[model samples]
Target: MNNIDGLDSWDGDRDQSVVLSEELRSRLAPPLKIGNFSVHSRVLQAPLSGVTDLVFRRLVRRYAPDSMTYTEMVQASGVHHARSLKKIMDVDPAERPVSIQLFDCRPDFLAEAAEMAVAQEADTIDINMGCPVNKITKNGGGSSLLRDPETAEAIVKTVVDAVHVPVTVKTRIGWDENEITILDFAQRMQDAGAAMITIHARTRSQGYKGAAQWEWIRKVKQQLTIPVIANGDITSIASAVACLEATEADGVMCSRATLGNPFLVGEIDYFLKTGKLKPKPTIAERLICAKEHLQSLYDYKGKRGIYQARKHMTWYAKGFPGSSELRGKLCRVDSVEEGHALIDSALASLA
Candidate 1:
């Protein structure tokens, strides 16, 4: 029980896999200190464009309290030019140790935006260089920065100098196979004063396809002295273990995997700390969580939050049979009452 420090309130039957080997326990339990903030858990929430809002982050936090979460990647230009983009900075003051990840090629805008993120009480300012979307890459941001390391370093340097909080970079292996630049790009960012780095382990051309080349992350980690977090293809306990063993990264960052199963980040964190695997939740629990997730979004975004909750519901609806049907019904429910009805029907059927 002393090993599992924070589960006194957990009602579910505890899994005994909590004892970690001294080697892995030592390796896995490394805390990341980025500038002024120290992350108690190394499992980080990657900045998904539309997915990692304040509500979604809270859901993940319930399970993984110390796991650091990120905001949806904001556009530096948008933050400077549009109040709409600035809205992304709005987060609960309790969501400390959260990073506001931003993207843009403009050094000046990045500096100003980093300052704004500091105002929002962000734990750190992260520059996103791994996004492969054409919109981000075409404008000289995201993985496109991989193709131009000089600009990437300048962006990091400007932001680091502008804010008291640590500056971090999340990036891919390279622009593509032909332009794999992670090793060099990571070095430049660190030299420019980045406190730590996260590598998603795929090239720009790979997009979200194929296995994340975690080997590239190993290469980057070998070259960097600061803490390096390994990402990509880390959806389950097995993959998380494999990636860490392969790359020797300081910690593992979870991205798309936390979609519906917010408990997964916590599950993995628990496994790392105690070396135990918890059983996956039952359908009843899943539906209850889905309803809670929806209500939280509605509380945060009102009616418009329904649209956002739809995707999260769909993700949670997976791993069991007939999930597609549940997803279909969820998509049509526009109001909280309607949404609760849909969950009720789904839970009944599952039961």
Candidate 2:
């Protein structure tokens, strides 16, 4: 396969050492069964708040058509009080196998919000028990649930009863280094009727730093009868392979690594299925995607989308010659036209 400019093939010594053994291929070949729902791909696109919006998910879906995608985590209380679907909960009908993620400490509000999500055609309801943001935790939500497993269990049981679709959870290992409570937490979730549990492998104190503790995932996988997805630090096909082999978990979820790189889930999924790496997108192709993303965001959300597109544009402007200067300009773009012009100029330079 052709390699992109400034991009290396997966034939490097490190990647070469990490092969997809026949055992792994056979193990992952079957559809991932979650409750009564079945997902054909072992790879999943994670629910990133403010990042996995409908526009971004559309791009990811274009590549990983069989993989499951998630909506940005919606505040259950916000939806319950407003009695209206939040734009963040929006899922295109065509994006099958997509889950609507909800966060809050109140089981009643979450159950009410889940019914609304099902009305919008959600394939599953995901509880956000693992978010580390203080804003979420301070209000008796997110990772704070780790400290309150009783409430977490109650939330899961209530939502499962309220929704026809399966109820799942995404969470970190524990409150901090001293409290690695995922072993007990994962089992409790299963008993409470969670169809699946995604473990982020980091404590709440670690935030996004430090290496993910995959060993904990192995321990959880051993105990839980439900499918366990390993979620921290899975950035590439190599890391995905290593994590799967080490944890022997059911699947992998792509997180921060997919920022500007929507092709990641598809790349990893292709490798797992075919044992071959798909060619990386060239800098020119990446810039073109950035332009499309900028325009689409503008078309969808207007002025506010332009502001949001700034971070996304900068994310795509990397690794090529003059990329530092290009990122500087892309991050300050005031309009879609300006952003398109900047990417066009960068593409011309690469040519």
Candidate 3:
């Protein structure tokens, strides 16, 4: 297999040591069939709230056109009453194989929202049962659903009945360490009409901490016949390969790692398909991408996009000399021009 430019194979990490077998390669090479729908790439871009907007998805799609991308999670109740669609649910006609993720405890509301999502050209309807935010869970949404399997199952069945597209779920292992009930929860979801499931491998309490317990993913994959996509801590091609081998999962999804690096999904997809690594972006190249991200954010969402771009800009300005300093300044950028100038200055200094 070929290695990424400027980085050693496995990035010199011994833990990433493993060989891709012919069997595993064969499984991943075929299009991932979710119920009746098919996705050409096994690597998916997770529906990150406040991050996986149109601008971000465009960047990722440029690199991994065949990969399935998701819209940010939208509130089912919010969509139920609104006459017009929420901006979050908007899908460009060109971005095929996009899933619109919805979060709520009300089966009726979720069913209604799924219809709206389908009307907006969503290829699939994803129930967000894995989000760990306090606001989301307090209202009986997100990871809190792990503790309420009956409600979660009902939501899936209702939405499945409501939409023509396949219904999928994204969830954690359980509410906490002591409550790792994904085995039962996953089986219930599949039985209730979910076409596919993505497991984050962390409990609700872990909240993005600790190592993702991929063992649970293996267990879930074994119990369910539906497509299982392993998520959490998938930061690189090596990690993606490691997770797939360890869990024998049907696919892998990139979450936090794709925050600034939209190229991640495509890179992994290319490796999986051809056994050749995509080159890592240089400091200059990354900064250029960052500048483009800032400009697009401003163009798409105006000043509010600039505020959101702050976090994205900081995510990109890392790993190089003076990057920490650049991050500090970039996060406070008040205008698109300012963001462009700062990234340009950092690129020049790196040269």
**Per-model TM values vs. the true structure:** 0.92, 0.96, 0.95
Candidate 1 or 2, higher TM-score?
2
Error of 3 at 67 (Å): 0.4
Report the candidate with higher lDDT, 1 versus 2: 2
lDDT of 1: 0.81
lDDT per residue for candidate 3 within 1-351, as digits (tens), equals 111111211231332444566877897888999999999999999999899999999999999999999999999888777856899888989888799999999999999889989999999999999999999999999999999999999999899998999999999999998999999999999999999999999999988878899999999999999999999878788888889999999999998878778888898898888776666777688789999999999999999999999988887777888988998899899999899998988888878
Candidate 2: stretches off by over 4 Å: 1-17
Cα RMSDs, all models = 5.8, 3.7, 4.0
* Strongest candidate by lDDT: 2
Give the per-residue lDDT digits (tens) of candidate 1, residues 1-351.
112111222223324323455777796665777765788886787777778889888888888889899999888898788744476678788876799999999999999988988888888889998888897788999888988888988898888889999999999898788988888888998899999999988888888877788888899889998889998867766667667788989889887666676787888888888777767777678778989988988888888888888877776675456767777888777888888887787777777
lDDT scores for all predictions? 0.81, 0.89, 0.88
In the range 149-200, model 2's lDDT, one tens digit per residue, is 9999999999999989999999999989899999999999999999999999
Clashes of each: 3, 1, 0
- Candidate 3 global TM-score: 0.95
Mark the regions of model 1 whose C-alpha exceeds 4 Å error after superposition.
Answer: 1-20, 83-85
Better of 1 and 3 by TM-score: 3
Worst 10 contiguous positions by lDDT, candidate 2:
1-10
